[model samples]
Target chain A: MEKIYTRPSYIREGATSGFCPGCMHSTVHKLVGEVLDELGIVNKTVTVWGVGCCILGAGYTTHDSFGSPHGRACAVASAYKRTNPDEIVYTYQGDGDLASIGIAETIYAANRGENFTVIFINNSTYGMTGGQMAPTTLVGQKATTAPFGRDPKQHGYPVHVCELLATLKAPYYLERVTCLDAPNVLKAKKAIKKAFQNQIDGKGFSLVEIMSNCPTNWGMAPLETLEFMKENTLKEFPLGVYRDKDAE
Target chain B: MEKRFMKGAEAIAEAAVRAGCRFFAGYPITPQNEIPEYFARRMPEVGGVFLQGESEVASINMVNGAAFGGTRSMTSSSSCGISLKAEGVSQAATDHLPIVVCSVMRGGPGVGPITGSQQDYWQATKAHGNGGYKLLVFTPESVQEAVDMTYHAWDYAEKYRNPVMILIDGVIGVMMEPIELPDMVSDEFIAQNKAAKKAAYAPGPREDGRKEKHPINVSDGGPMGRNHADWMKYEGWKENETDVEFYQTDDAELIIAAYGISARIAKSAIGILRSEGYKVGLIRPKRVYPFPTKAFADLCPKKIKGILDVEMSMPPQLAEDVDAATKGAIPMEYCLTSYGVIMNRDDIVAKAKEMLNK
Candidate 1:
């Protein structure tokens, strides 16, 4: 009998990922692994992980990966890619890491057109910090920090990272995708692959913002958060290709 | 072998490039702005990377990234800017990255002045950042010394897999002086340096040609385990890395202890006083992190009456180390200035005479 399916060789065998049940991190990690393997650049790829649930990738993946201080993954990736132009480098950052504390790093790196990929995980809340309201936290959404719901009058509006980066001229690609179901997960993988491919093609900065879910942080069942995502989160952060220089 | 006239900050940049530093990311600030300026022009000629980060924090993090890629990387700033880089410095310490940081210090509790000051002595050698991490701090007293120290800093950094700091004040940073610049490192040396121990941690194909299967995680041994290991590494530096100079200290009844630009002022005082039959000398600490406590221990108590701590800070920072070294056995005096005030040679001479008379 022919083998039907196999895990990407980049992921460690029998290694248990420490992500919470129904967390989208594992799904995104799988997509990255598949993309890296498909490109045959797994050996030359360097993944800089932001401080959050994203850091867990360092444990699950077998490639050369390391953790940067919270919100500085983009800066780190920029240096690595510039110094080692022949190698592939990317940053794995959460919304809190990429959109809040690290917004400047992310923006500047994209502005400089650093040839690197950025996998941004927008989970609305600070998943690693017990569901605190993040920069991407939806207005009127309930978070631990926003117990009564995010009030725009007090707290700021949710940051649309893809739309914000779309205004930058240097970015080569910018797309927002979700991993809500099997079909959506495949689409998310395609977008992530293209982000990496743009770097491989010597294109400028590319970012794929994955609309993720945190069941544990959201205080809901894994399945319940998926429904909530479509009804609420998607309304604030619609999925689409915000920018694609290649298409133009 | 050719001597070149250059500013202290430019000499430092040239020395770093000669020492095989191929990546530089820095933010522009007073006194040290020449460093990034020089790199912007020179790095392109050498086929190296130069970046002016949006902030000091981002610049240092970029250096961290380049260092992790197994390149000789650096970042520089002045006192207040160095404060912003504290976070990246601590992260580099935790990761055991071989990166060089230069501080052409200006005055500061917070942006006090743009002129020269030795206010960052404690920040450089003692509590540079969180976790009580220490850098192998080199305090160069002159422009020539600054170039020399910056050139060799990368070797020490890689040898210990730790950050090395070149701590000079704004006085030296702006002053022009003649110095012999080292020859540029060859391409082979750069390749060998990167492939030496970097292959183990950097991404790419392994020498054995086997694909990596394990993640490059820093917390594998737990925080306590890592911290204890780092503590041992720091302790080893005391014996192997301590560097100092004893200038006519053998038979002196009084010695002036200083570092960097303040040491240059103290030396002038020592010269004049020694010629006039005053039994005064100087103890210059080249590397301050190890504190050169042994240099103090080696001083003969019978001949040394007291030590004068000279610095361009409001209160002396090196005095804490001097006290720790002598354990209150030696009486100490301070001739101090602050807020970018250059230390006066006459004031140090007066302070030393007053201490000797007592």
Candidate 2:
């Protein structure tokens, strides 16, 4: 099988991207856009992008996109998905947007089993502005505000949402994967594909948390940033399918 | 024509089924519980969805959910319940959901009275999901009107892609009236809307894994998307006015504006004034939101000093709308706040004289 792959026809004509030289968000956006395009849902898919670095998703993707209030992507996306159930809707949020401020909306939507896909980019530090503490930032990981590393006494422990959501019955697919390496990026794509497929099949809520790298924010070389996310982030958020209805 | 002598609430539920409403979600509130219960029994027969939500908020959001899966869906509640639903209502209106909501009007800011009152007339028409957006509010005076207005609400909801509210206070909700279900709406109309729902959102394979991707899609990205189109869709609704049911405007001074059961009482009050050799005009608004602002502006009275806006709210919601219509050209007074059943004819006549005399 000579499957020399060319990107889907819907892939935009441009260089890799304007993202930081080795940024993982661009790869993640590409994978998601590719799936949306290949599934023939590019015209129908609506993506609600939350504040922070990912806020530029409306311009990044060709899907019908909406920018939401901070941490309100899930709330707005929930309403958008419910009203236009026919439309393929997804929300792209950073960990701060999904876990900290949007805790109620994210948890309830997953618990209620609202049919939609949520792509959580766990970069461990807020990337749009100067790096700061994020819910997913490692306990001992240092950032601008947390220059001394996230202290358990002052900062809460990192939240493992994929593991947290697995306890609920609503999610059809839940996976925590990373884009720090070639093999891991492929795995993340599979998880995203499954999430979108679950929505298409109406199985239930689905989410794929991608351990993305912010080279510039991490103050590390592109290769080092990838290695740090793999060695550090993946250790806290293990890479695996936390849930699948058929597994049981 | 399913000619059943039905209560106002029951007629509304049946008309929903007739109008292709397959999904209904509601919280149990006084006077409108029949609507939720009726749909509960009837929805299963036709393979529809009926859910009793944990709270009014969840109930409204549930309908919002069902409305997306491409069903002509609805929810019914009273004043308190609708108050709980305002957040979801704003989301629905902004998101432009084609959903029908039946508010069997009751009294209150906080669980005032359950029997019947048009006190919520203003809130139903104007208040927000606390966000200052408005929805279409229809006030039906009789059980027959309740049924037809509810059916038409579903029609207009899909047409406008926003929530449509049918406001009926307790008297109309509980009263049994003979209604001719003239088979006026065909099964084809039902099928057409159902088809629209399906085409809008068609389901594919599931955990079963034997299906293609039934994509969830909505096309809009800033300027190139449907956001502009969605707003343009709302502008057309401005043209379809359903208020101002006028009774004898010719050579009439001292006209009064009222709605729902109050309008019925206002008519009798007008007759009372006429016997005393005074020409009184009655203007009833069937649709309270697209309130007949233009028509009411015409009847500010050549000789009379002002118009009496009648309602059942203490602070009076209609006074504001009346002011908008008259541009404050005429001083407005209120025949206000019937906490339970509508104001009696004599009470309204007395209020009218007090306002007109002043």
Recovery fraction of native interface contacts for candidate 1: 0.59
Best by DockQ: 1
Among all windows of 10 consecutive residues in model 1 chain B, the one with the lowest summed lDDT is: B207-216
What would the TM-scores of all predictions be?
Answer: 0.97, 0.74
The DockQ assigned to candidate 2 is 0.10
Give the per-residue lDDT of model 1 (tens digit) for B182-218: 9999999998888774685555445464344222355
lDDT of each: 0.89, 0.75
For residues B1-358, could you state the per-residue lDDT of candidate 2 as single tens digits?
A: 6677988888888888877787887879897888898999998887677776656776776676566455788898998888888866776665566888888878776887887887787677766466556678888877888787887777788777778888888878888989966344555666676666645443311233212221222345643355566556545555674566888667676777788887877888888888877667877888887777777777544565667877776777877887887888877777876667567788778877776656
Superposed Cα deviation of residue B75, candidate 2 (Å):
4.2
Task: Determine which window of 10 residues in candidate 1 chain A has minimal summed lDDT.
Answer: A57-66
Query: In candidate 2, what are the lDDT values of residues A1-248, reduced to their tens digit?
Result: 89677664333445344567887888898789668766867666767777788865444444345455456566555655765667787889998888877666678778878789999998888888778888888999888989999999999899989889888987777888888777877888888888888888888788898988888888889989867866787788888889988587
Residue B279 in candidate 1, Cα distance off native in Å = 1.3
Model 1 regions more than 4 Å off: B205-223
